[model samples]
Target: MSDNLLSRFLRYVRIDTQSDETSKTFPSTPGQLVLLEMLKQELTELGAADVQMTRPGYVMASISANTRKARVPTVAFLAHVDTAPDCSGKNVKPIVHRKYDGRVVKFPDKPGLTLDPATSPELRTAIGKDIVTASGTTLLGSDDKSGVAVIMTLVERLLRETKRKHGLIRVCFTPDEEIGRGVDKLDLRMLGADVAYTLDGGPPGEICWETFSGDAAEVIVDGITTHTMEAKAKGMVNAAYLAGKLLAALPRERCAPETTDGRDGFIHPIHVEGRTERSVVKFLLRDFELNGLADKGKILRGLCRGLQASEPRARVRCKLRKQYRNMAYWLRKDMRPVELAREAFVAAGLKPYDHVIRGGTDGSRLTELGLPTPNLFCGEHNAHGPLEWVAVQDMESAVSACAQLAELWERKS
Candidate 1:
């Protein structure tokens, strides 16, 4: 199982499936389609029934039930195929340390970069286990490729072992999770699962059902432009200068990603662009509570109003929109999905623990859409960066947990 998992992860990471937020296309990038198509072929070859890749780059398949249970619920396992656009995923050369001895690890491409186990306590736990990472020049693509491999391996295992009693299982590989548009065009009706789980979490035995409610905001500042020779404070209003002032006015010392942790929320300005005539500033507002998320939006709106009033000559406008919500809001009502995951982890010889993500996942939206989706760990760490890594043993454990989860669902029915 370790060998197969490692090979699948290595193959998936080598294909550059980084999503592009700037693109208007469905999958955001063509490379994502490449991987999605590949997954469709693999699932079909693995004897998975109803294997299909949607027009929007969603690969959906199913493993028929081998159990005699009459009322087993259809369970769906999900994972994203696209890597984050924040880091370079092109030509990702995954390096597998066959036997990880607790020591300071260095990268071949970057002489100055080093990963010390002492600093990263999670790496210490995998002292004698196999570790995988990328060269210093690129990200390891472990953010979700690890999840993809785990699901695929589970499918393979279930198919090979016909004697393992389990109900029907659905597999879905989504694209563009990094930019938070993973399920924008998802065919939920076609997916047809009573419950779902996303294999997109960190560490081993981690189950996340809570996530930050998310909103996206864009501030467009339109100003007058004139030649420097004729430029005057009263005659010309520089949008770029106003944009900088608005950014500076933000509560960076307190209400920002760099300063916030735990359940604390933040108003993060991610992108700023344009020139003296016009500027666009995009921000992401996040909080675990809906009221807190609304408060962050209110803060940004008040700031925008202030900027408009201060510079009457320039037109300032802010567009705030919903992205995803915390899954806890819905999961708390019926925690069967989360409870099943916990029992499955214990069955796999792992002590399960509850966790909350400072960020949101595809499961967040799926839960909101009435799927009751929870998140499961695939051993990814330091995601969306060049220092990303995963343990082979941990991935195998995740596969075991997934298999146990299927059996538990069948047994409960």
Candidate 2:
């Protein structure tokens, strides 16, 4: 199982599935479709039932219930197929260090790059386990690829265990999770599951029921452009300059990703584009609570209003788009899914504990949509960057946890 899991992860990461946020298409990338098709074939080969590539390129499949008891809930397992666009995910060279010895690991592709336990405290915990990482030039794509491998492995194991009693299981592979469109087109009725879990968290034994309530803001500053010779203080309004001023006015200390941690929410400026005539600045507002999230929005709108007041001739429009809300708001209403996960982790010989994600997941939206979905870990660390990695043993444990979770649901029902 370990060998198969490692092989699957290595093979999957080599494909460049980085989603494009600017693409108008449903998936935002062609490479994602390639992987989705491959998963569809793999699920069929693994003897999964009703395997098909659904609309918007999601791979959906199912396994029949082996339990004799009637009225067991249908549980779904999901993982995203797309990697983040934050760094290069192309031509990834995954290096496996068998039995790590608490030594500094260096990247051959980057002479100056090294993974040391001194700075990476997580590596210390993985000293005796097999670790997988990419060459310094590219991200490892373990953010959800590890999750994909874990679910695929789980499917393979459950199908082989013909005598194992469990409920009907649904497996889904989604796309564009990195860009936050993972479940936008998904039809819940077609999924046909009472509850779901996204294997998209970090470390081992992690059960994340809480996430930052997320929203995006686009500040467009449209200013009048004039020739340099004819430019005057009153006649010329530079949109680019005002955009910079908006950035400058953002809370530098309190509400930034770099300065905040734990339960601290942030207002992150992700993209800035355009020139003198028209400039657009994009921001991401995140908080664990709805009111905190709204406060962040107000801060950005106030800044835009200030910019508008400074130059009445220029138009400063702040547009806010609601993304996934914090899953805790819904999960707290009924924690059966979380509790069952905890029991399953214990069954897998893991000391399970609850965790809160600073970022959102597909489960966030699923829970908000009345599915009561929660997040489970697949050993990914340092996600969305060159230093990302996952331990093979951790992924194997995740597969075990999911399998145990299915049986627990069966027994409880």
Candidate 3:
């Protein structure tokens, strides 16, 4: 299928692949497997060898080495198939804007919501490019779907042009990345790749190798309940009030998402559920360094202890669990991967910007598993929200970069 990135991306996003965090299943959602199965069948039709899909919604396919060189290293390209659980991925309606002029863009479905260049500065970067977005009611799923199109397009080009020499290329599409369980059950050793790059970043010409070290914390508060007739006379504690008190007592100066940016970490309360007798507040803690994350965890624990001291009759517990670590700092033993990606971007006729991402990707977990996978740009902007968009030109540039990366490695010998 020689479909354009726009067509391919639209086709992929038409399906609802939102992952579930509460599900105990490996993939967390059956919809993810539908997309993964589609990719598996399409890869097989594309003549990719050793195509296989795992029960957890990981699809792996390989393109054999075309070069005669025996020393070529196996490289992989990856993206996720699932969309974020934060937004509705059901019945997404993507709108295309051709030859964008610098103006205030409005979503057709929403009369009041506007995407201004001043508020979303990233829109400024796509002034002259063809942009794609969803209606105001839903996210476009371009976060990684555009990434899927980029890799798929590159595969078609490499297969058609027999003269293009390259080493073995492995393509992987994972699920539940938005929920942070994309690679939880991945079989890295079986997949067999020396190095990899995830097409899962924002803007064009970006090479991200560093990501935040992350942990999820849950605060469980238990309270006493009394009859309404004797509420004041009998001992009664409101757990929801206790949870809110602890949330308000959290350090907002240096530990809040709004107060931090560009490598500084934050403790963000993403979800809260409570009753009069019980309440649970979930937080995501992030830091570039492990010690910083540990400090945040300590602060949370200290808050719980203080709450206990103030309310001896109530039971409050704070538990911080590891999600993923900073991949670049923990596993990258060489600079060649970073340099090669830069070279790839330059070959695609664009300057590359390498930065420490404020968030995590599937590459973060894969790198932690010893593959040293870095992230490549796919033009995703304002991801996981109704304001998400992707530039067509930027996606084409990413596809060119992927192809150039293969050619560069072949020429490296």
Clashing pairs in 3: none
lDDT (C-alpha, whole model) for all candidates: 0.94, 0.94, 0.88
| Candidate 2 lDDT by residue in tens digits, 267-295 | 99999997989999999999998999999
- What would the per-residue lDDT of candidate 1 be over residues 73-128, giving only the tens digit for each residue? 99999999999988999999999997899888899999989888777888898899
Model 3 alpha-carbon miss at residue 93, Å: 0.2
TM-score of each: 0.99, 0.99, 0.97
Which parts of model 1 have CA positions greater than 4 angstroms off?
none
Q: What lDDT does model 1 reach?
A: 0.94
RMSD of each: 0.9, 1.0, 1.4
The window of 10 residues in a row where model 2 has the poorest summed lDDT is 225-234
> Candidate 3: where is the Cα deviation over 4 Å?
1-3
